[model samples]
Target: MTNSRPVVNKPEIDFSDPDWKRHFQEDFDKQFSLPHLRDILAIKPRPTTFSLKSRIPLDDGDGAATGSWNGYVNDDDRALLKVIKFASPTSAGAECIDPDCSWVEQWVHRAGPRKQIYFEPREVKAGIVTCGGLCPGLNDVIRQIVLTLEKYGVKNIVGIPYGYRGFSDEGLSEVPLSRKVVQNINLAGGSFLGVSRGGPSTSDIVDNIQAKRIDMLFVLGGDGTHAGALAIHNECRTRKLKVSVVCVPKTIDNDILLMDKTFGFDTAVEEAQRVINSAYVEARSAYHGIGLVKLMGRSSGFIAMHASLSSGQIDICLIPEVPFNLEGPNGVLQHLEHLIKTKGNAVVCVAEGAGQDYLHKSNTTDASGNVVLSDIGVHIQQQVHVH
Candidate 1:
């Protein structure tokens, strides 16, 4: 009767038990309310309409209704038209009409017909110059330009060698193009027309154009090349000469302002994905190892983003748009260490321009006025080694 204390029983705990771990995870999930794959994949449907008046009128032999524009829309072109029609409109009072706007929805031939060349087909001397860096599908553009001009009945087409300099360089050569010369050129990569850096004065370029009697000039390059083309066009206009200037933007960087997607971008991303896969394999093969991959993206991180998303093998991705740290509790190095300690391996995909702020800057510029970037990949590798 004096010892009336209540008897108590203690609960036993086992850390190594699989059922204990599973129960712990279940409790954690219940407390945190983690998201499910089904929730992420569940996207709501939005209303869309594809109905539109046919842009291309029935082709009449005379072709008077269409003016200089050829009215032909393929299935792909029709699909693009629907996308343009459904896309968000530009802000009010915008100066330039959006390329995707309904007003510019008509699918016309890339080569011109709203404007006519001042010369006849045989007398029309056309010059094609490829400036800037290499890009995929350039040969295709060249071949198409040649064939289209041929369709327009132009026989004198010349390839300006080594970019805009071909216009003024005395020793630089020019290649005469024919249907046979460019027949199978598109089978290869790089520009068959060749490319170079820098250009001559605008007046000198205009003089060369006049000397060659080139009625049409097609400039294939990035913004820099387009600037040169604009200068040449202005000079020709000042001299009261009628020369049609066409620009086909080319850049593997894919940083153009208004363009949706540039040529060579898909190929670049595909190649990058292969590298990411290789990194993943290497990381998985080593114990507590980390594999890092660097991709091409000087000003924009499109390549890195696309590669990481496509491969689905990357543990972490760093881009220029998002700033990251190398030290501190929430830094990349800490995160990598945590990942390796927990999962035994980690993979990182970084863009070339991801960590510019962490490095010393250099006052270097390329021929196209692009600033030379520091090697972010090497810096990251060194930092990883130190940590």
Candidate 2:
């Protein structure tokens, strides 16, 4: 089978053309744009009561909003794209895109509290669901959402237990939520509402939303869960139902696009550093020893890369972004041998999703429809033993 890289035949235009700027700006805006309520329904917004800036101790929850809350983000506010373009020998972005390599200012809609909200705070019944696997800051995220909604004067807020399963599960029920209820929930790790994988169909979920009379829904999860939220949004729109679906993305893998970083990424990297240190100690203690640390990164290698960089003890770090071979004159096995001969010991860190191309492909998937990854860590360990 051929593993040749597919050629991207980009339609070329003169870089000096004055219209290129306009074209680029339009394309960029289209890519990062979010749909507003006006796009679907012509609902007039109500002034938000999220003006709580002065209360030093947040639980005081009394009296009128200070209104002096310096700024409320307007719909037109945009955040400049902060991440640098990562180019390599194969991906020479600057050389290919422009001879000057200068980029036009890239902006995305800034996230924060808005002065006017589409839903009437008191009349709105909000539902929150945390889906997929647990992450480090799920409870904190839930607590913040509840607190923010309370600040907006929302009276009816409920948690959908165990991800989307609560939507159609025969026995599951919604848990009433409030600022007081979720005040200390952040002290705990994992999701306060718990989480599950795949659940009932989107149609079934929307049906439950209608039955529960939920006007606003906050969905927290990774890619698959976000896809489900999008489906729910479309289903609600198709039925001409007045429902707003907001997704607060969550994942430890740091795989989300157009985002600087996700909530759980820093924590994951910090935890992985400790593990790498342990591996280093273990390897250093033995003669010609090798310590292999396998980390979790289902899609991206942020944890493995950051942890290795932070620990400074890892001799080699393997990630999905860069390719490596297990066997050859210039393969990983050769490098390990070189390290053993020179350094007497080595510490290697690998991301779980790395080196999947070498494995036999599987059609099996987990409950969330995520592909069941072959154990690359165990394979590397076995190869090390044999070598």
Scored by CA lDDT, what does every candidate get?
0.72, 0.83
lDDT of model 2, residue 276? 94
**Worst window of 10 by summed lDDT in candidate 1:** 1-10
- Across residues 1-387, which tens digit of lDDT does each residue of candidate 2 receive? 111122232366456787875776688699778866677787886566565464232332232334454566878999766334534325543322444444556678988877666776778899999999989999899998888777777889999999999998888999999888999999998888989999999999999999999999999999999999999998988888899899988889888876668889899999999999998999999999999999999767888998999999998899998899999998898899999999999999999999999887789999889999998888998899998
Q: State TM-scores per candidate.
A: 0.71, 0.89
Alpha-carbon RMSD, candidate 1: 20.6
Cand. 2 Cα-lDDT: 0.83
The pairs that clash in candidate 1 are 68-113
Instruction: Give me the displacement of residue 127 in model 1, in angstroms.
Output: 0.9
Q: What is the lDDT of residue 181 in candidate 1?
A: 96
Report the C-alpha displacement of residue 10, candidate 1, in angstroms.
Answer: 68
Instruction: Quote the lDDT for 327 in model 2.
Output: 95
TM-score, model 2 to reference: 0.89
